[model samples]
Target chain A: MKPPKTDSSDFILSVQNLNAWYHTTQVLQEISFDIQRHKVTALIGPSGCGKSTLIRCFNRMNDFIATFKLAGQILLEGQDLYDPAIDPVEVRLRVGMVFQKQNPFPKSIYENVAYGPRISGIRRRHQLDAIVEESLKRAALWDEVKDKLKANAYTLSGGQQQRLCIARTLAVEPEVLLLDEPCSALDPIATAKIEELILKLKDDYTVVIVTHNMQQAARVSDFTAFFYLGELVEFWATDKIFTVPKDPQTEAYITGKFG
Target chain B: MNSTRQIKMRLIRQKWGDQVFQTIAVIGVLIALTTLAALLIDALSDGLPRIDWKFLTSFPSRKPAKAGIFSALVGSLYLITLTALIAVPVGVAAAIYLEEYTSQNSRINRIIEVNIANLAGVPSIIYGLLGLEVFVRAMRLERSLLAGALTLALLILPIIIISAREAIRTVPNSIREAAYALGATRWQTIQDHVLPMAFPGILTGIILSVSRAIGETAPLIAIGALTYVAFLPDGLRSPFTALPIQIYNWVSRPQKGFHTNAAAGIVILLALTLLLNALAIFLRNHYQKKHS
Candidate 1:
């Protein structure tokens, strides 16, 4: 599908002056950005630059930490997620996350895919079977795994495990998908397969990906946001960020002068 | 040339030292095994003929051939049932709360952690005295089976908590994060993911603690359990006698026959503990295979 033309009206997630702290140390400093609906946005930065921390904030995953503190607002479809009335659990269901490491549960492959819908209170056997098959098909893993749905998930190779994780995320039919370097642990062939799936996913889901590989961001995303030391250095169209970045730091990073 | 000679000498010395350490370790194992073997042989020779249905069925008596351990067997069973019921749930719940729910870096959580570690090393007899004061006196449980069970429960509670925490900790942080990412609550994540992976380890701990409780004699003696209970305890509050007390009484008597009876009782106790340990090991292996 072609990239949606630039439009602020299509922004599905908006962060405004978001500041985050882990204990006494501040991590994300006054970060503000927008995630357009049905578009792939790639967050690119060196290690410890707060890209993962920023994306985790979208789902409030950092609330699990006692020392974690954040100020400012994260608005998902114009709703303030940090509002006391909004349950973090509810926020997570609507905005699913896939971790860097392939972490399939220690259960059968079918059960792993069905985990999200099961916890959301769907209990019928036949309905779960249909959801599991459809999700695996969308993830491009159905043909290889259709016969062995009863087998354990770890029996699959690393690449298959990563795709299985994506299928698990999609089974819940989330409005947005947050990926934290989802391909960092996989081989090249697995990486290509996942990129294809993520590109296909852009037609239906808002995708926010944090990646260290510059070429991957360029290949898959429509918008690119560069961060440095807890601050947003630049955010623009992927083409402009690659060719003529507005910030010198972004230019140096893209040109490989320094991290 | 001189430096090469020195290096050769140093290598030879290191090899010699390793052999010496290995010899010491083997000697230590042999010494322990020899003592254990002696005890087993003596118990078997004296007790094997006495292990019969009649020997198991009759109550204690003045006549040596007629006496049995019926009441003591029944009392021990009741005590363990009560102990398992009280200790397993409380110990496991405390473990879950500490491992999954609380932050390890927080001051209060750290303090609780250190205290639980210290409690595990505290002498079992100390727990007995505490149980005597708390359950038997303050709670007015008397010298009944309930008091004995509660005392043993306190004795093993620290063990259960420590093992359960270790088991829970073995589960990777990634699994928990995945569950939470799917919108599962903290309780749901623990019950579904953490507990299943940790069940085998927790069962191992419970087996070990219960076996230790069964062999314990001092705490029961300190709590004033009788040595010659003629009948089974009627209920929770009724007075009781256990296997250890009965054996102690028989061994202390002047009659040679009671000593034989004591050996026979020791054999029964050994069989009971082994049966329990085997059952627990079977369960742990079954779960580990299923998960791994």
Candidate 2:
């Protein structure tokens, strides 16, 4: 199979003037950015800065929150994702999410990967096996887990569990992957492995990550957006943003002058 | 030296207070256990001599000397099955809707929740009144097994719902998030992940409710359950008698032999409750082991 053509101009997702609220409190104020195809875009901020909320909006996970509401446009491949006609379920299928904590379903490793496909109407055993293998391999977990595909997911270590979550997301063949502080619950070594996997994953899927660690953003992302108090302070190439940002607040935040 | 001695005396007083409280707690627990043990022992001693195959399988007769609990036992079984079948689904569905689907901010939902909590605390006999009005008279299903089952179902619905909601609430938010992130729809996540995790808890609640329903005679009698059901009920429309009703009837009779028969029936009822409780415990332990 030939790889899909992805250039800088091929933006996979575009968000414009996205305002979000939690009950009466406005949590995200007119956040706007474009996610380029096959590139890693990291959203970095301090805690409670709406970094996670912004990413959750991409796939409409915030719909579950009773008080959560959003305004403005989120377009996937130039189509409005939040349009009334578009199903959040279908949007979630195309744009998969991995949470901060490693949350593998209470099932076997094989079943975890096969879950998405199974729900989406894939029933043939051989096809599901192939998808599971390919997804686990993509997440860099196939070799460690190959012999124990039938083992319970909880038996794996924290890092392995996070990777299993990734593999589970990948099994559905999503075009874009969202990671909400994927390494926040991991140790340094596990964080490094995930960072490495992120670099590799960008070659295939458009990756958007939320992280509190500035170094992680610098290490893995191509583009980085800095958020402060529900506002997007600045967004630019990762190297440029870290070295010489346009905004003074971004500079202070990145330099540890203030949050 | 004087100040130091005073401080020591104060410390001794505090220690004595702590000991008093601890002793009270221990005594309270022992008192409860003793009461329970006495009840069990008394029932066994009184009922053991009367417990025979003939006592179990034979029906009640005009003479207290020849009475048994066959009709009552069969009726209790039927009532329990029907009660479980009706109450479990309605209670679980209400609980899931309240916990997962409905918004907490809505007034109607809040009212429903409050009513359920109040219902759990209401006297069982009060429920009998409601049953008489709704199931027997309003529905016009008087003096039948259906009315009795419906009445029992209403009595236990609140308990099952409250317990089930608690169980569903204890499931971690992370599990739901994991399922949702995988593109599983709300129903799918509930069906595939949440419900399975909550199953053991729901089963436990159902077992407890069913046990309570089995021992209840007031509500059944209020709905006009017959005391002398000589033959087995062929359908839900037939009049029925349960174990508690039989015990009540026997105990009211003016004969020592009838009193002994009632004691025997009480022992059987207690045994049935203990067995159900044991099954609930086993299910909980099995679920914990499998999940952990």
Candidate 3:
């Protein structure tokens, strides 16, 4: 098999013939794709289709699972992510993630945002304060939480909490942000707000989002990949995939004929 | 119409069963409370007159009226404090390793977990024997406060580890994942997020175990804690007598006045346990409020 071009300026992440398994059960099969730099790429599939598993692989979040195993390679700007000398912690630093459910630390709002910086050994109060403000502002949550920065993070509304998690991720200054169905727990309004944030974030960070919602993929992503039964059935520009999908399964899924 | 009537009858029977369960539970609570109250009242009635400033300030004597628990009380305090200082850090670190670092499916970890649980159930007297053989004889610490403290520390280490593990497990995996996704190493994740979140629970466990250590008699006696220490322990190596040992010695005497002193010793020991429990509850609530 020919190696995928990594020197291309457009792509920031490349997955080549990746196969993933949880113990004996394979969840992703021979998946290959490139995430465009500074663009949102959405992974859309049904519940068991391995979309979330693929997103987790980008930042090595799946490393925590005892039975998780994978073959093939994931490259970040041509560097092998699974190389023995490269630490998972370093991978996560460059590629941050947000989970499906909102998970702000059980700390004050300001502390929640500053946690990443603190863990990275930043000690000066002034430095942390600036990072907190900037990250929260970028998440579009600064105005709502600024007055009550000391309030517990659990006090925030679901949407605001989700944004706080996003701000927490941004504080580490990652180059790529992988959001695993981040709006699944939110109401329509909250989902819309997060979708808006994702769009704004694409200008600065490469984004890979997994969503069950077809319209969300259409609205936020530049490219969309459709997975079916652990296989990539189609990958194309978001408009073309929705309008004229080459795979019948992809078309059927987007049209709500079946999961 | 017949089926509807049957349904109504079944609902009424179910409600009666619910009431019966509640009544049984209430009866259980009443029985426990009454026994505790009776014991407290009996101890206070017998010992209240003997408890005075002089009683607290004096030492044990052949004359029952002149005897006090001053040395024993101080020794008990020192023992529990030392036991906590030794047991807490060791227990919590062991718990963290078992919970966070090791795979639950591994054979060695499963064996270790089972042994720790078994250790919690092992009799305290057995711990006394171990302490006697190890700290007192082999280590040549003699019948000193340090030996007694080491014995009690071993006695409660299992309980502390069990509770600390439970506390650490309660810190949701989501919080851990959040910490890791920000590039935090495993230790960093534990130090910054996991430990702080589990702090309240760990503290409650530590205090509860320390209180148990304070009331322990068999282990200390088995390790040969002095039954009558007239002078205070000057340091860790000095001979010591805890309240329980002092009480045991007093109760065995034929003199009625000595029995009264025994009751007074029981009262003070009970008070210390209650105070420690109250502190545990307070700190648990305070930290829970702050963390959440």
Candidate 4:
């Protein structure tokens, strides 16, 4: 495999003229943007406006939908993600995703965290334990779960389950962590914890989050991309997007005029 | 004020309709259970008298008083074990393929799914004929226990596969997303997450389907399984006699004693079915409890 040549050292992901469709109906039309390294970029948009769809494109998660089709390039570290030579599985490895719903496997909390490492061929008990502990600590869940790592993941509360899911993703040590409305299902206190975890995670990983809550976007994101009607309405520094959005639609959405 | 009366009248009518539906649903369940209970009582009164150790241990004899279900019982146990060996993996695999690997958007996958559902509805005797043509005549597995097992496996396969698919389908998409997001291949995701979660449902199907297999007489007869075998099957190639076939033979005899023996045999069959069901339920509940 040839190494992808890069123009910008700061950008870890670059989307160019990316258009996606479900069969004949296009949902993402000519979307293009660059996400910088080690920064949290938030994708905010109204429901059914392609916030989830756009993030799914990063890990090629939409390929399971038989009718899903996309044209354009999603470059990860400068390599074309859609290239036949580049397996989607490998892309997913480098760019791990945490879904909006907290979906831990029916396995134990320990097993859940170790699942990725095990698949990647880490077998020693000590090594797995170390990884699980380190990952859970990073997600700020080690204290609650460490004593009963063998317990079923479902035994955890909703917030804890979401944190367990985050730990599970982190165990894989991905370069980019994608959260699709991670706190939408969580309560205010749990949301605060996750938001803090996301801020901490950006020190080591490039973070992409999709949130419906505008306050959340303002609080956590360094950069914000506002999408409307399957189009990128505005993208700017988070403070600027919240304070003085160039697009009137962006202004209306943030001001709670109409979503 | 007149419109408010009309609205109140409409609400009262809707509540009455809901009560009618609720009663109908309860009555439907009661009818099904009562019929099953009536049959069980009749069978018990007729058979429970003849269920001594001698009747269970003795082989089929020309004399009705001397006849027993020993060989048939052994043959059935053997057949069931072999059928499970062949059916469960194959059925579960086909289910996984349809549910996890292939999307229903493809014509062939949809066709296969539709056909499996149709096959579940097809008469067991038709599957026996299929086994006769394919395994017995073509493959030359002549009247052997393996041939009988293959036939029964085919008969119950659609049921197992359809239920397995339903079981697999109940595994939410979010679980799959978690595995896939961990960079798992499709096989890894299914093997690691999907199958385990779907197992309780699959086990329930297997228990119900295998019970159906045990009670089947026509299919085995159609496939040429022996009605009366004095000895246990020597191996997979040996001719076999199942409980249903043995019961059929006794029930057909003109002797009043043989009919009583037939009833006794039905008790053994019922007990065996319950045992099988209990074992399946035990395993299913055990796994479900541990996982949760």
Among the numbered candidates, top lDDT falls to 3
Determine which window of 10 residues in candidate 2 chain A has minimal summed lDDT.
Answer: A1-10
Provide the clash count, candidate 2.
0
Query: Lowest-lDDT window of 10 residues in candidate 3 chain A?
Result: A1-10
TM-score of each: 0.96, 0.96, 0.97, 0.94
Off by over 4 Å in 1: A1-8, B1-7
Model 2 residue B253 lDDT? 93
Residue-wise lDDT of candidate 3 within B186-272, one digit each (tens)? Answer: 999999899999999999999999999998999988999999888999998999999999999999999999999999889888989
Which digits, one per residue and each the tens of the lDDT, describe model 2 over residues A156-178?
A: 99999999999999998889999
The best candidate in terms of DockQ:
3
Model 3 misses residue B279 by how many Å?
0.4
Compare candidates 1 and 3 on TM-score and give the better one.
Answer: 3
lDDT by residue for model 2 (B93-175), tens: 99999999998678999899899999998888887888899988999988888999998999999999999998898778899
How far in Å is the alpha carbon of B237 misplaced in model 3? 1.5
Residue-by-residue lDDT tens digits, candidate 4, A1-259? 1112235459899989989999899899888888989999999989988889999999989988989999999999899999999998998999999999999998899999999999999999999999999999999999998899999888999999999999999999999999999988899999999999999999999999999999999999988998888888888889988999878999999999988
Which candidate would rank higher by DockQ, 2 or 4? 4
TM-score of chain A of each: 0.97, 0.96, 0.96, 0.96
Off by over 4 Å in 4: A1-9, B2-31
Docking band of candidate 2: medium
